[model samples]
Every structure is written in C-alpha cells, then in structure tokens.
Target: MFESLGFEPDWFGLLGREVLRERRAALIAEACAWSVGLSDRPHHLRLRGRLVATGSTIGDRAATGQALSGEEDGRLELGDARPGSFQDALNAVDADGAVFADRFDREVIEPFVHETCVLAADRARRTRPGQWAELLDDLGEDGAELGDVVRAGEWEQPLRTDAEHLVLAALGTAPLLEVEAEGLPLSLVRAAEATARAAAAPRPEPEPEDLSGALFLALAAVREAGLPAPVPADDAPRLLAALAEQGLEPDEVAAVLPHLDLAPGTADRVAALLAAA
Candidate 1:
C-alpha cells in the first residue's frame, strides 16, 4: 500500500507497527477489566456477557464447554487480528462502536498521520538546491557570457520579470536578479531565464491521501478541545463544525479530540450526539 502511494515501504511498515502497538495499548488501558488478547482472525471481538475475547474465534463447542464448566468468567480479551490494511483495521474498530473507534483514532490514526507528515517533510528537505549555472545554460543566446557576469556579480540592469521567474524556479527562492538594465551584463537575463525554467520543471507533489487531512483533523480536534492545544481556542468551533459537515458524528469526533485543562466531559458531550446521528 505504501509503495502504491509512493511512500517508502519500510517507513510505512514501521509506522504501521507503531500504530498497532498504540491501538492495543489504548484499548487495554480503557477496557476496564476486560482481558485483551491477540488473535489471527479478521474479526476477533467476541462478547459473551462480560467476557470479551479479542483473539482467535472460539469454536461453538469450546464456548459451550467453557460456559458449562463455569470457566466463562467476565473478562475482556484482546486478540491480534492481522488486518488486511491500516484503513481496514480503523474501519473495524470504528464499527465496533464509539469507544473502540475513538480510541483507535486517538491512539493509532492521529499518531500515524503525524509521523507520515514528518516523513514527508524529511523527504522535502533532501531536495537538491537548484544551481545558478544550470539556469544560465538553459538560455540559448548569450547564456555563457551571462553565466560569467552572474558569477562575477557585475551585472548592470535588473532582469526582466520573466527572467526573474527562472531564478525563482532554479533556487526555489525569490529572485534577486533585479539590476540596473544599462549596467547589467546581458548574461544575467539568461541566468534568470534558466532559473525560472528550473523552478517551473515538474516536481512531485505529496500524494493527495498522504494522511495530511487526517493530521489536520487531529489538530482541529485538539484546538476545539481547548487551549494549550497547538491551535487557537477560537478556531475550535469552526473546525468542529467543518468536521461535522464531513459526516463525523460528535462521538466519532470526540474520540480523536484533544483537550486542554479546561472543560471536562467534552468528549462525552460530543459522543452523546451519537444518538442524534
């Protein structure tokens, strides 16, 4: 999946493992006496009275035997079901109801999104800075002489706006090609032109589904939850409303919501809206 999306497979796998670990931890912490165990089945949750088995599917005969023998004590068992994909696991937990869904997003999805963005930024940092000579060479006429003048810093006039564009392209920075046209060496024009061409050359954009949107969602939830969050408190309601418009119920929203030291049970209130949904 990561390869298909142009991500480093090893990085994706590392992130995936981290997400699974976090998900398990959060579920265990919140389970309240439920025994969580790992299972190989896709759907591992089996709730019998208070005994919740999250691992391998118990055969009917075994379940009956356990029930008859009084071994079906009240406990929650978590299983390690190998989900087909990260998204599949997320959806499974979501469908399990508000509590599991919320925990999954908070413990797994949000962190995964954060790490994905970090990776993307790291990759972007490795992009080679454009060269000035390379820009000059792209200019057909007077390219070489202009390259020399640019190197010597003895150019006269400011490059034309179009030439300036080239400089911006090559350096991935604003052009400083402006000079007194009369005193400017002709070479600067070609330099600027080359820079613009380099800048305009196609470069890969981050994938549309690179978890940025998920990160934004997590941050917005935090902002809405209150101050000490990375975003302003005033932006919370707007962000929450936007998220609501995306078909997330208050409970689902609250599951991934971050909170400040302020208002308590904010998540409960949000989750309460699940009924209205």
Candidate 2:
C-alpha cells in the first residue's frame, strides 16, 4: 500500500531492527525531516526511501509502518497522527535548534486554515462557541497574524458569501448541503473580513488577494471520506504539485483527473475553480 502512494517502503533501512518503542522514535525523526510535507504521503515516503537507498549499512529495523497504523472503530486509522502537535514525538530528538520552523506553522497557520474552512462549509455539526472563542484567543496569543485579522471583525462574512459560489466546486457537491452553520468555530473569518475591509479602503496598489483557505480543506475532507481514491499511498509529487499549483490548466486537469478519484466533470469544475482563484 505504501508503494502505491509513491513511497518505496524500505522499512528495514528506516528502522534497522529496532524494537517497537524505539522504532516509534526513529519514525518520528524521519517524519520530522520535512514536517511541512509530513501531511503529504508522497513526500513522507520519498524521504524514508532516501535513507535506505543511500547505502546506509544497518540491521533491519523491522516494520514500524505496520505499528503506525491499526483499526479503531472498525475502520483503519493512523496513530500519533498529530501533524501539528508533537507532544509525543518531541522527546525523540532535541529541538532547541532551528530544525522546527514548520512546527509552529502547524498551529499558527494550519488551525486558522482549518477553522476558516469549517466556517465556510456551514454544515450541520457540533458547535462550540466558548471553546472556539477561547481557542481563537489562544491562537492570537500564539501567532500575530491570526490575531490581527480577528480584531478587525467582519472577518467571516466574505467566506460565507464566497461559499455560496465556490463551496460546490470545492467539494463537487450537487443540490447543496442542507447543513446549517450551527455557529462556526472562528477560523478564517477574521482574514476574510479584514480583506473585505482592505478592499473597501483605498490603497496605492491592490492588496494581494487573501484567498480563503477553507475551500481546499473542505474538498479534501469530502474527497477522503466520501470519494473513492486509489489507496492513499498512490500519491506522488506530480499529483501533489498539480494541487499546489493553483492555476491548473485543462490539460493538467485532464492528466490528473484519473489519479484524483474525482469524476471527470467534478475534476474539471474543481480545476476551473482553482484556476479562477
């Protein structure tokens, strides 16, 4: 399965016969090499594959990957899956130095991105106002950017407005979802409201667009939970790059549709939305 996702699982080289507990620590180190791409299966695999192929003489570490995943609630799930919080894995290596730039981004940038999308989705779900307000305060204390945006107020209206147009394309939904906002956890609302205010005000040059990060996250969640994919491991740089590059052309869109697990029309719509963004 790992192989299908563009990861040549050289499990032996990565672990070198280490015991299960030790293997976990080792895996943490390997995954941290480029934590920015840690969420990207293809990138993670590519890094692991590098350690073995480079002629590192070591005993087989055994299969740490196997241990990293297991079934819970009759469904497969990944363990220690905190792409942001490294509470468990932090002790594996000393992080006093500058090797942890991306770690803060997990919280500073990532959560806002997620919260923004959740608000945009406006779906029927649990709503936590007190918790969200507290978290927003916490995020602002943790990062300057999010705070600046939130203080502006009116940060969420555009995203909710844009959701009317882009959400369908983002999630490839038809007939629209009946789910209500149920009170959104303050994510990208601050950013959206701030951008709107900026646009309304006069400036020498058009402010760089502050695109809502919510749409992508929403689409990805729907795709993973509802869409059919070629086993998560089948990911690759080409496919990931296409996703990162916002201006996806028709040809590029066509080329990647097969791998996306999205319908042809849905993929085209997604491509158009991305391109227009």
The top-ranked prediction according to lDDT is 1
**Candidate 2 error regions (>4 Å):** 1-45, 49-103, 106-184, 205-277
Model 2, position 167: C-alpha lDDT score: 23
lDDT score for candidate 1 against the true structure:
0.35
Q: All models: lDDT?
A: 0.35, 0.32
Q: Write the per-residue lDDT of candidate 2 for residues 1-277, one digit (tens) a residue.
A: 8878987653222221222223333222222332322222211111322311212100111111111111121111112422223221121112122112234334333343335534322221124445445545644543234334333433433333332223222221111011111112232454467689999987688674433343454335445444344423233333434454455444544454554454335554555555765
Which 10-residue window in model 1 sums to the lowest lDDT?
Answer: 172-181
Give candidate 1 regions above 4 Å deviation.
1-99, 128-277
RMSD of each: 31.1, 30.0
TM-score of each model, in listed order: 0.18, 0.16
Q: Write the per-residue lDDT of candidate 1 for residues 22-73, one digit (tens) a residue.
A: 4443322222111122112223333453434344332231222221111222
